[model samples]
Structure formats: C-alpha cells, structure tokens
Target chain A: MTDMVMYEEEYRQIQEVCARLHRDANASAVLLIDKNGQLISEAGDTGHLDTTSLSSLTAGNVAATGGIASLLKEKEFTGQFHEGEQINVHISIVAQRVILVILFDERSSLGLVRLRVRRASDELSSVFDSLLAKVQQPSTPSIFSEITDEDIDNLFKD
Target chain B: MSFINYSSREINCKIVYYGPGLCGKTTNLQYIYARTNPDAKGKMISLATETERTLFFDFLPLSLGEIRGFKTRFHLYTVPGQVFYDASRKLILKGVDGVVFVADSQIERTEANIESFDNLEHNLYEQGYDLAKIPYVVQYNKRDLPNVAPIAELRDLINPEQVPEFEAVATTGYGVFDTLKAVAKLVLTELKRGR
Candidate 1:
C-alpha cells in the first residue's frame, strides 16, 4: 500500500483512456475495481454513485458469475457486460488482477466502449505486470500476499 | 494448474462466485457449506468489516465427490462487493479456473446485476480468460422474495447466451446443488477434454 504498488503512470494511462471513454460513451462514471471488487481508479461521477455498495455488488458479481462460468466447465473467462436503460456499465479484467469498470448513460454505446477498453487493457496489463514484477523481485510486502495474520486480525481490531 | 500439485492426485480448481451485492452470492456458498459433509469441506473464512460485509475476501476449500483417481478439490472465493475494493477483488480472481454468476431475480436490481456481471467479464479478461469459452453458469437467486423477477425474465435479461442456467433459492438450499453440480461437471468436463 506504500504509495500504491501500481505505478501512478499506469493508472494515469487508465484514467486517460477512461476519460476518453466517458466522453465517447457519455457515461457518468468510469471505475476500475480489482478482482476483489476494490475500486482502484475511476473517471466521471454523477449523483447515483455509492462507492461502498457498488464495490461489494461488483465483487459479488464477479464471484457469482465467475462461479457459474467454472461450473459450465468450458474454459477461462474474459469479462461480462450488463446493459441498462439510463445507466450502462462495462467491466473488463485488465491485468488478470485488476478490473476495469466504465459507467455511462444511455448515450454510451457498448460497441465503442468495448473496442476502446480492449486496447487500453493491453497497455494496462503490461504496466501491472511490470509493477508486480517489481514487487516480487524487491521482496516487499504487496497488499496481496504481504498482509500477515496479525494485520488481518488488526483490520477487525475494535 | 501448475500452482496446484497434481502429482498428489488432487484435482484442485479455483472456483469464484460473481454477482452483485445481495444477489445471494454468499448465500450460495453458505448453502454449499451447510449441506456439505463436514469431512468434505475445510475452513470457511470471511474477511469482512465490523458491519458483517466482506472487507477483502472470503475463502472456503471444499472436497467434492471424487472422480476416477483424482480428488475434486475446489477453492471457493467471494470478493468484496463494495466499489472501492477493486484491488482486493482482482487479487482473488488471479488463477481462477471457473466462475458462477448469481443474478438477483428482481426487476429493480437489473442495473446492479448487469454492472456486476459486466465486471466479471472484465476481471476474467485480465486473467486471460474468454467468458464464452469458460465453464459458465447463471443462478437466479431470491426466488422466495416477493418482488423477485420470474425465471424467464431473468433468463432473458441476464443470460441470453443460453449457458447452463438454474433457479436457486440459495437460502433454502433449493437449486443449490444443481448450481454446484453444473459448475463442477463443467470443470471436470474441461479437464477431461484436455485429456
């Protein structure tokens, strides 16, 4: 968690892509939720944003659907898309460890967001892979594997 | 699969549940744990906030019915649903082999359901997975609820891809086994196909 293990530049690139997506999709917000459903980076904001609840919902989304995907026993999965009336969100897994979420209004077309997000995801993956390599090689504690049982317990310390 | 030791004859697979909050995602896991024989399942851990909401992730290791010579072992994970928890969710999704989507069968929850569903795809892509190629299934939970959407409507709205879909009242254990069976079967089928 020190200064964020992921490089700031990588996130800036994600933000740039997200901002452009927001303009193109005309959506209210674009967010990046990790595999654990933690919001990493976001763009665009409107009134209907609830950070906590939405994060939980998104994580639950990945868990439940991903479970089924495994059950079907087909192959690995890429991502899922949910379309709504006033609000349409597109979520994609970027670096196998990061989730890329984009929220837009009816003005956002699924086609445009899907296309741009795909390109951005490749760049995002390289950045993350590099960052992960740095973390692994340096022998530092990443937010992922570094937390000790004590740390986890302290999270619940009253 | 390299992360797992197959030489030990244990077929370990990472199965993740993906859905929106309050979509019975945890409930589905709970039902699976509750119904499983004590010897077949291991520790069920939930890393949640004081409010009882999942903070980072929840993990449970299960040993399902074995096959041929391999023991079917699965590591089940539930990611934190809050929006800010993307970092944690991505970590949990690493090296996943299968996914289950729990769609709340309520009309009003359509937006949340879709958002959560789309998030699943995004995460999988990062893991180098193809959603269509993955062993996937859909569970329409909360069927006992008053305002729950009909199964047909839920099917039409959520899973137009026509994968293995089931109606689950995860709380009462209805269709829970069906969901598990579908996914496990698919997982094993995939393993066999590779053979």
Candidate 2:
C-alpha cells in the first residue's frame, strides 16, 4: 500500500490554496480530500456540514466515475458538478492523487468556480508533487525503528 | 494507503470488511457503529438499494484512541458482496491498508465464502497491493448457527496463512470488537515497521 505523508510545509500550502479557492470562486467552502477519501485540509464555511462523511462519499463518487471512464476508454472525468436547490458541489481531481471539492450556493456561478478551481489545482499539484518527493526520500529517518511492541500495546489498552 | 499527517498529528488508515452476500459484512460494521462512542465515530453511511442491500458500500470512520500523541483514526468500509457488484468492490479497495474478511461459516455458503475471498485477492492485486503483503485477518462469522462449519475446518479452508483468525457472531456483537482489534493491531504493527 502507498503511504501518504503530509509535512508541515505541505499543510500550509494546501491551506493557502483552499482559502484562495474559497474566496476567488465565491464558494461556501473548499475541501482538499485525498483520493482515498481522507480529508487533508478544509477552508471556508463548513460549519454546518459533515466534512468527514462528505469527503468519503465524494471519493467514492470519483472512484465510481473513474470506473465509468475506463469503460468508455477514457482516462478520467476531471470535473463533476451537482446542482442542488440551494447549494451545489463541484469536484475535480488534482495531481491524480487528491480531490478538490467546492461547495457553492446561488452567490457563486459555475463558471467562476471552474476557473478558480483550475488555477488552484495547478498550484496544489506542485505542492503535492514536492510532498510526495519528500515522503519517498530514502535519506529520511525511519519513524518506526524506535517504536517497541509495548508502545503498540499501550495504544489499545482500555 | 495510510495517511500520516505530522502537521495534524493524525494517522488515518482504511480497513474494508469483505465477504459474500448477506454474510454479515454490514452486520459487523453495524455492531461497531452501535458500540462506538458518538464522539469517537462519524455517522455511519450505507449506500444501499431500496431493499437495504448494500448498493455501493457502507462507510464508518472511527477513532481508536490516540497513540504517541497521534490520533489513530480508521476508516471502516464494507464492499457490496453480491457477485454483480464486483466493480464496486474493486473501487472500494483502492487504498485499503488492511482487510477483515468476514467469512460466512454456514455450511451452504462455503463456496460463496471462497469465491469472495478469491475476488478480494484479485481486486487488491489490481490496485497494486499483494494480499499477503498487507495487514489482514479473517473472521469466521455466524458461529451461533447450528449448520455452520467447524472452526478447525473453516480455519484450514479460509485462513491457510493463519493470520489471527477469530470466530464471530456479528449480529449479537460477539467477537466483533475482538476481530476488529486483532486486524487493527496488525495494521499498527505494520506501520511501526515503517510500511
């Protein structure tokens, strides 16, 4: 299994990208989720929403859509939009490893969201590319060598 | 794939419950959801059909306490077990860090159990994961049923690798946490070995 490691530097970059996406697109919120459905970073007004479950479901939706893309002999559907009565969602794959999900209402237009997301996606892709390189560095010290069996048992102790 | 965030002090790992149709994969998740503290778990979401059969998957995000200042969160998922839903099953295994195969112990469902297990292996392989190399465990479920296979026979047939198999009756919550704990421990141990 591939491991996803987020260093402090990458977190700051992702937060900046998300904040810009939220403001520039006039969207309610911008969430950066891993393709595996883990919420990496979130910005904007997500107070009333359940980001955890939303992230997981969004990833599932993307994966299902990607499956459809394969059947159609395409690489992937880069963007998806779901219009709702009050709010709408726009999801896009960034760097092929992360998902950019934006939630907007009548205040924002689909055209604006797409434009901002595309720009932010490119910035985020570079940030993630560096993060991936750092994680794959062979010179990095091991996080587990010092961990003992007792350390693991202590975690599950009731 | 396990996501370790040094910035947030969180470690998120995906664990998928897999088995044949109506073989208690969803039941295992339901038991865990019911037992888990509300503060420690997210809402349980089931993407199912009108008949309540899982259509895509059932998702439960759980926090199993913290370890060394890092919150250990496990995202639990169950793949739809019907043969026709094989596509959905493969999609769910995309970044799985570990698997808990809930094999139906009923005598009549023996073949279904084997087929599902084989399918799991194939799907994992397609996603660039070798089943044997990843953290995994097996659960012989529905042990309370009188028509179930014996533990010894089930172990020989289902758990040839002997990866911490457990006997469970998920509906009653019997051995459910035990099975979960076993696989989670293996996953954490693997992480300690630096992936």
Cα miss at A68, model 2 (Å)? 0.3
What's the lDDT for residue A136 in model 1?
55
The residue pairs in collision within model 2 are B1-B95
Candidate 1 chain A least-lDDT 10 residues: A149-158
Per-prediction DockQ: 0.02, 0.77
Where does candidate 1 chain B have its weakest 10-residue lDDT segment? B1-10
lDDT of 1 by residue, B1-195 (tens): 211222334455667887887777777788888878998886576777898887767766677754444455676777776666666676676666677898888889988888887788898787677788878899888888889877777777678789999888888999887887777667656544433
Q: How far is candidate 2 from the true structure (C-alpha RMSD, Å)?
A: 1.1
TM-score for the first chain in candidate 1 comes to 0.76
How well does candidate 1 score on lDDT at residue B190? 58
Tens-digit per-residue lDDT, A42-134, candidate 1: 778845566534654675667656656666994546678887877777777676566777776666678877877777787777767776666
The lDDT per prediction is 0.68, 0.91
